[model samples]
Target: MAFLKTIREVGKYFHDIYSGVASLMRGMKVTGSYFTRPGSIVTQRYPENRDTLKMFDNFKGELMLIHDENNLHSCNVCNTCARKCPNGSIEIIYKKVEGADGRSKKILDKYVYHLDTCSFCGLCVPACDELALKFDQKFEHAVFDKRKLTKVLNKPGSSSKTTNE
Candidate 1:
């Protein structure tokens, strides 16, 4: 009776081992099929075909200040974007300037954006309220010198040129 019980236990162990092997083989077969199918490869050459590539509509790329036809950006130097930036990459300096009506308005003296430290979060854009900021989809930002990555997106005193101009 003892020997008969030992044989039953061995049979059960072998059955379990066979089931595990069968499951493993099934998984391997799926992987093997994928390897043989050249059309199933999901990798794309990024730099070689950047023009054909498309980014998400909401993809956060880089922050830019939009200049209207009047050579002026809508940013009122509210500093809301600088405060809301999680990475502290945005620095806006406000300068008091007299408008054509002789009224002093807070204008942006300097808009410094450190692209290296920027998280590319769109939080700053909406926080602007004036719609002065936007995400530009130019992602070819790689540079040999890290310092070159820090840039001022807006040109000084030339913010009013329209796209046609």
Candidate 2:
């Protein structure tokens, strides 16, 4: 019985070793394929191709609020995006005001976005049921000062449905 237990343990150790070796070979095969392909270079030339360098559609860049031609937005200040963000990157400051219908309504005071804290999770864009938020393809986020990262999305004289009313 002892001999059989020892044999089983040895077999399990060998199995683990084989599995590790198989994974290593698989990874090495991929690396070898890439190494052999000189024309398959994927590195971007950056500033040289700045004018032609287009980011992929799925690339997450700067978070922005979509506004109409008249500087009107659809954000109701519902806080859905702020709540869904894994990091506290979005701060929606809203104020209650009397609407045109005489009912109290909320409007965006400041749509503060802290890009420094953002994880680029893209959760906030979809969480916004109003479809007021989106990510742009402007990848140039390098700034000398960290304070520049914090952005207020609302443009000057911009107003939402409640505020416009």
Candidate 3:
């Protein structure tokens, strides 16, 4: 009975070794196929393919305000985007401006966007009911200084149409 138990243990050990070797060979086979099939490899050469490199439509890189040709933006300064931000990346500063009507309305003065703090969760875009916000595809946002990461999204001379107007 002891000799039979020893034989069973040896058989189990050999099976484990065989299973490991078979798994290793399977992985190596996949690697070998990739080497032979050049088209199967999707490794991109950076900088050289910059012009041809196409970003997907759904790719979320950074948030930017859409300013029209007339320098008119759709942001209503409702503070929805700032409030919806999970990381408090958006800081909006606005002052009351007299609209076409006699009453005063809040117009965007400064839209501070801290990129470093932003998690790129894409909450701010949908929070804007005006559809003024969008993700900018240009992903090269690296800067030498942390202060430089803070960006003002509202362009100069850009204003939104007042609801009362």
Candidate 4:
């Protein structure tokens, strides 16, 4: 009876080893197949194919303020984008000036954007009721100086068309 028990233990050990080996082979089968078929690789050749690379329309790259051909923007300086920014990445500097209509209104002086602190969450885009803020597909942001990441969205001499008019 003892001899029979020893034989059963040996058989069970071999069965456990076989189960482990089978599981390992099942996992390696995928890797081996990919290795054998090199053409199945899906990685894109970047930088080399920069000319042909077209980013999707919905791809979020950088925050931008929409400007017309006249260099005027739609931002009303309502502070909606600044308030909606999760990381405090947006800052709006404005001044109240007397318009030709004799009414004091806010004029956008500067729209400071800190790209380093931005999480690219895109909350600021939709938060603007005026549709002023948006994400542009300009993702190649590699730079040596971190200070260069900071941007002023409004161009020089550009003013908000909403109140200026």
- Alpha-carbon shift of residue 164 in model 1 (angstroms): 17
Global Cα RMSD, each model? 4.1, 8.8, 4.1, 3.0
Full-model lDDT for every candidate: 0.78, 0.88, 0.87, 0.89
The global Cα lDDT (0 to 1) of model 3 is 0.87
Sort all candidates by TM-score, best to worst.
4, 3, 1, 2
Between prediction 2 and prediction 4, the one with superior TM-score is 4
lDDT of 3 at 2: 100
User: Candidate 4 on 1-165: residue-level lDDT in tens?
Assistant: 999999999999999999999999999999889889999984666655677768899889999999999898999989988998889999999998998889898889899999999999989988999998888888787899999989999999887887755
lDDT of 1: 0.78
Candidate 2 C-alpha lDDT tens digits along 1-165 = 999999999999999999999999999998888789978875655565768887788778899899899889899888999999999999999888887789898788999999999989888988888899889888888999999999999998888864664
Deviating ranges (above 4 Å) for candidate 2: 1-44, 162-165
Clashing pairs in 4: none
Best by the TM-score measure: 4
Candidate order, lDDT descending: 4, 2, 3, 1
Model 4 alpha-carbon drift over 4 Å, by segment: 42-48, 140-142
- What tens-digit string does per-residue lDDT give for candidate 1 at 1-165? 999999999999999999999999999998888889978975665566777877886767778888766567676677899999999999886677676677776666688999999977678988977788899777787889999877776676754222112
Candidate 1 vs candidate 4, lDDT winner: 4
Clash counts for all predictions: 1, 0, 0, 0
In model 1, which regions exceed 4 Å deviation? 42-48, 68-72, 94-97, 103-105, 138-144, 160-165
